[model samples]
Target: MPAEERGKGPIVTSTYRVQLTPEFGFGELSELTGYLRRLGVGGLYLSPTLQAVAGSQHGYDVTDHSRVRAEFGGVDGLRKLAGQGFRIVADIVPNHMTVPVPESGNAQLWSVLRLGPESPYAAWFDLTFPVALPVLGENPEFTVDGDVLRYWDHEFPLRPGTSALPLDELLEAQHYRLVPWTEPPGYRRFFDVSSLIGIRVEDNEVFEATHRVTLDLIDEGVIDGLRVDHPDGLADPRGYLRRLRAFTDVPVWVEKIVIGHERLPADWPCEGTTGYEALNAITRLFVDPAGADKLIQTFTQRTGVSADYGAVRYEAKKHVLSLFFKGEVDRLESALGEPGLHDAVVEMLAAMPVYRAYVNPGEPPSAEAVRIVETAAAEAGRRTDPGAVARVAHQVLYGPAEAVTRFQQTCGPVMAKGVEDTALYRWFPLACLNEVGGEPDHFAVTPEEFHAFCAVMTPTTMTTLSTHDTKRSEDVRARLAVLSELPDVWADAVESWSGQVRFDPALDYLAWQSLMAAWPIDVDRFTNYLLKAAREAKTSISWIKPDPVYEAGLRDFCRKAVEVCGFSVASFTAVVDRYARVNSLGQKVVQLLMPGIPDIYQGNETTDFSLVDPDNRRPVDYAFRRALLDNPDDDTWDGQKLQTVTACLRVRTRFSADEPYFPIEAGRNAIAFARGDKAVAVATRLPAALERRGGFGGDTVMLPPGRWRCLLTGAEHTGRVPLAHLLSRFPVAVLEGS
Candidate 1:
């Protein structure tokens, strides 16, 4: 709580991620400190706390930056959490603010809407005069009451002296217009969600205004660090980060998603990304790439979807750009000051490998950015007009400021909606690889490659397995990873299950995958997740385009899947259960002990079979977890997982963040790493394959020439120890060297 400790990152090695909602506010969090402390937590990583819309769950739709949300007990609650002696990393959203329906929650947005471009707050938003609000449905009606315009539970401010104007005249007289939801406007937005309008953090006054309270909190030492939300959405990511670092002296990290071999931009002044890149490396290390052919064949033949990741991504990108990104496309085309380049631009965007190019106008693109653009352009040229593509690409890379910024901003959203959301849901050969910024077709990462990734990582960068945004939990992915080693048996089970409970053929394979991975789930949970999956795929249904008949059939099929195929799914799970256990404990220990302050999502220490967002956000039964951690030697998966995670956390706390990683090559089926010289982690990968090879065949790990004690089992050994004995009790062994 001293200002002297502010800039120094968390004093401990690990932080626990908690999704704070109205139900589990600061008071509730204060209650969990005892448990977190027992679990070796050094800091508390929180969800967004700024005042968002009423009853908002995730809190990213921030409405007020000057005040914390009252639903979560506000400024006082935040102060209390900080007082609990946990270094606080407050998640702040400076990129965008919510455009709530009532329009009064955000006073800045309201003032801008009421006063047009003349308002003092106009510079805070990325809107123009006569802001076009795309909110109308068919048969739209509006009424004006004293100083207010009303539209079906939505209220807008009336301009001065326009309360008595005719309905159409009043609509035209206001500083904003209500158009059909189909007609999206040209204001900068967070991806395709028009309601969450982007803000101009490039402006100094706007940055100060939006970040005032948080900065003050940092000065007071109520917040020790910051996790920036979505920096790529900014006009100048470098300038924004530079300005951010200037304002506060604390560790800052961005929610940046880096693709394969694409490192974070070196110029950005931040620690590192929130660790999707590490997530990819950790999950893939458990996968068996040799099984990719069999899995892809099964998926393609059974579901009739393309196994070519590139083609699936291209089609998905093309579909999303046409459906939701027309505004962005039109904006880019206009900025380029060119004609007939829309197709060229869309094709290039679809082919883009990274999220966005950080090319400023008049400045040459960075080498990495150049490589990314060249790769995409080469692919785009094969499909579209090469001349047009070349023209648009040249303009975006080296032309006017508007053209460059517009192109850079458009790339992030298109990649997110197309690849991560749509294509991931559509192409599911191995669901474990279908994560954010993950390649489904590209299967495992060799231990050497994983070490290469860890070698370059900033030590303070956060590392995680399951996060609030991951497609599946660590446990779910662990279960799914087992299928790669048993693809033949999996294919036969799916083929048999397909003959019984028939849903949409496109979704049948995915449903089976999810059901088995997130087993022991209820019918409601299973069906709800499948519905979301169906919508994300955008094949049979979508969030905006619902097919009730199809949904009903899907639900009916879910019931049948439980009634008839449940036994088979259970049988299939039973066969793969031990391997899943190996993966569950292996990945958990690796994440906890690996480089970069390891972070654990709430309830992940034991077992979490959750799917995406709402499911992931479900409350942690901490009392149960506390009891389990109290007696972690009960010979169950939860007990073993908790022990392994706890052991790694305790060992990790002893080491400083600056400690280097030394990879210890164990064998073909194991990954071993020594952090500095005192701690070493060894985890089993592809346990089914290891079993096929008959238990390591005398594989051994050379310890760092000292008597080492296993943190999990308390077994001590010297020199080279056979993994068969070192990891006899569990799939993972955490050793502390003398």
Candidate 2:
């Protein structure tokens, strides 16, 4: 294919969690290959496929770099599937590898652990002490050795005898039984996660070993591209990426988290980041900041917490520092050679002009930022070692600022207001909270803005709507947009039921209920599981265990609330019915019409209302997808919806054959674009709450003279019709000019 042909239409791709065998079977790759081609997807963007710890659902904790995972049909299956014409984009983790314990039976990892810092593989891992030391959390009496650590196989320990001694005791042990370190006295590791020992991939040898398998796949034409995970964790990402680029001409994209105004390194040879910024921008555009503020105030008043947003933000920072930073600080202290060097580093970091917590590259500071650190040092009542204080301060300021900001944005309201009578708070931060400070106006990409972004994109760049990490599924977000228009109705419903339920962490509990109604999940056993999760999160914040009395009351309240809200036992059933039709249609619209390559997450072309992480990585029902694709005319609603989306996908593939490019025109609450004289696409983002405006061209972009006919509804209009009327039946239109 010509280079221009590759860049022409939106590239449709799907993300498959390698661990979810049911979602994308290694054995069924042949079947999946045919389906992907039929669906017109140009590529498959798979999650990490390297051998991971057993039962590892998301596959980030890779155990080996050389081989494909047996759970995902291994090397043979992958190559066979790649032969089917869909480009393969493999996700690779270079920063770290899973620490192998005894039970894993991996002699190589065990050898590294046993040999400690002196082993040939020592350079592959980042460790602080020359001797392997046990990591301590809350419990302080346990110990972990090479043999013992390897013995412990489960996620959470069950019995002391079943694994190594407890973690604390391992730290206190005088002599180590595990791997001994080769480094002098002090060494450093990444973040405090011992199990996830960082690698020195910047080393030429380490880089070759890590890239060998991937490069071989590329050579065989089995893998078409790469997504480098955690680029920030590496010491020299720019150099590492450039080196990788030297090996292959395949497209490479870095998974870099964009914190505020941070731009990608100009030297890195990659297309673009996986679209988190785009997601953040699009989501913030519709969230009601005033409403969020009101919720915060209401919660604060109810809880008697005097801390404002900034204060709460500080507290969250302190919490993370206490939990995850001490080890990193110790490592940095050792590296600097000076006594109290950690504090000095922190002081300099706090005083630095720019915040680059993870990767600091600059000169030693003047005294101004030091003065601020000194004040903090004095307040702690100890003669704060200036160096130590500075280091700690730097950790606080730079280390987890983005995560802290995200948590503050999401949980500020919950922390401010105590949960109703239960006096509990929401744990971590809920997704709803993060939507604040993300006002659409803050980063919304209008047509002009999108054009600016597009101007920067080479034909090799990737574009997407949903990914494995997105807070809400794209279809869910589209439906949630309806709420922006009908906030009053939702508010009224909440008000009516406010007095009936006695939920601990009241606001969060109520919020969960509302979320349940808004995005109805399976009401069978699945509903019970979700309800249990809600209760668990509530109790964690409340510092209380589940109570029978409260559980009964909650059940009763839910029943009454449903009754009052005119919902039936069939409410969830009704929701699923409508959601199936609407969301499926919405997916088809986005997949086909959106500019750039449209990437579909594993199973997202159907209904996937999964929450973040583990939830989103659940087993895919490939059988269902296969059956739906095979029987496009099935009578069932979900099957019908699937057929509809598939049909539209087929049309998009056919239309894209001619290689059409569209230029957009803005409307009051709508957007109009033309694809030559053959077709024009019009889309409305009408929030139900916004007043219905005079039509597409009132004060919006004036439409050019032409007779246009709506493709879906066949309505004809000379010049421009009232957008409100045009959009009453359809949120989007693709008009074929007569």
Candidate 3:
């Protein structure tokens, strides 16, 4: 496809990552396509469609790369859905594959095991010790001539005649031996995720096979683009991407997490990342940095630790390194071909700069930073040999800074040390903060940031808000904006309710924090989602151990608090009325205004009240969304949100038909740009507090002489009316020349 074709119109996309079961059918996808078309979405960006292990919800664990998953209705269904005119972008996993064992079926398990390095598939995987890698940390009593690997299959049985054992007793054996690779069978492999054996995609044969599957799909017109998952995991990302691009015309986007201003290699054939950095920029712009600082200090004081940001940062880095690099060090040592060079390389890289040096205008980190890392490595070398130290350092430094930043942010609450530490710290805060970088503060896409983003965000790039992995649904985040302005209201309610209920103040704080963070609003169908999440979290003592007996008491407390604080059921109803008005208007504005192709995850146009991961991945309600799409005049809030989104999309498409190029000038909380003077899209992203503070004052916007009307409210204001009144509704003005 031509590059301009991808960017010629507004993009509306959605993510589908849940397991494909018989319950979800071709009819559902057909209905979904029509709904999306009505919502003005340009395409459907699906998660991996390749067959995955049984019951895998997020289909990243591919077990068969060549076949479409039957549960999702296979190729015919996909083609039928694609015929609806929605572009299809498939998420592909090229870095690794799920290793199948005897229980999974084929008898090639034993053949591959006994053949060792002689097996035809030996070069397909990145195996460590081909000769003796133990499958389950066991030393088999008998050594076979060929490579031997073991699997923990509870189904295999020993013959009674040979072993004098009952079938059930034999089946109880913990490990079954067989080899998948010929290398030393006893040594462990990298990625530490044994079930997901890594592939050497840099190998010509392996690369060809992986590319063939994707190429075939593109050839069949079932897929328009590709999203590469975990690019950093590959040995040569640039090489892999280049080769993949060579075979197909489809646009490719790598899932790179940007930190600071680091850029992807300009030479690579892919466009840009999944936009974690953009998400971060949006959140940070809105979040009060001073509030963040206060929370950090208060957390430290309460914990009574002599800790700075760096210390917490280091600890979080350590945790991620442990998970991702536990076994990869030995592999690095062998590759470097020197006893101490691995450690040296690690120290040098860490000190060089956490970000890609080439992308930054500032010279890499100061020499002092390098010197400091060297010093630390030297000391570490003394305790654990230099080679070992370097190995550890390499793993730590190579991991993305975005991951490190996330770790640092989470460590604050983790260090607070609550019951069910696992539940409190695992994914909640990380998901909440994932969108922070996209906010205006940290990564404003200011004229400066915009220039940078524009330079990077090409046609192949994917822009989104609610993915399967996001902590909160997009609608949830949208509603939470209301709370950002009412922190005192939340704080006061929690305080009074905590006192009345006699719950631990700290625990009460955390509970309220989660509630505020979750932010269930009446407008976007999120209140029910919030209630569901609360109930789900309550099931596991891990998230909150609010005395079991007090579960009802706590819920009642919440009910009363929300009511007494004027956020009661009746108040919530009132808020819903306002939300209906705002959400419809806002959805239309976003659908019409954003420059990049907009992505709408399944069911989001009507109401998306999901939480992160599994919650977001729940089977989309195509029936409901289809009903809304079919009924253009359904007098409901969700229907309104959909209608507005559709209207904006139509407007955007019409405006960009002839002349699409334009320049954007920055204003306080607003972006002003002219679309050939046929229309001007002035998007207001005012902070809730600023909006409540009577809005910003200034005639910072200088427009060409003309009469203008706010596209949203249709309130005409000519010749530079007060920018404040013009911005009251967070207007996205599409001014037409009179």
Give the TM-scores of the predictions, in the order they appear.
Answer: 0.98, 0.71, 0.71
On lDDT, the candidate that comes out on top is 1
Candidate 1 C-alpha error for residue 634, in Å:
1.6
- Backbone clashes for every candidate come to 0, 40, 45
Tens digits of lDDT, candidate 3, 38-157? 555565677777777666666676777677777777878778877877777788888777654542332222233334455565666655323323343344333211222224441222
In model 1, the clashing pairs are: none
Per-prediction CA RMSD (Å) = 1.8, 8.2, 8.2
Runs in model 2 deviating more than 4 A are 1-24, 100-106, 130-194, 285-311, 336-460, 506-514, 522-595, 622-663, 672-681, 690-729, 734-738
Ranking by lDDT: 1, 2, 3
- Summarize candidate 2's per-residue lDDT along 340-439 as a digit string, tens digits: 5544543332232212222323423324434433454454324336546545555433444332222111122222221211122232121332321222
For all candidates in order, the CA lDDT equals: 0.88, 0.49, 0.49
Best by TM-score: 1
Please list the residue runs of candidate 3 whose C-alpha ends up more than 4 Å from where it truly belongs after superposition: 1-22, 100-111, 130-192, 288-291, 294-309, 322-324, 338-431, 435-456, 481-484, 497-511, 517-592, 626-640, 652-669, 674-679, 695-738
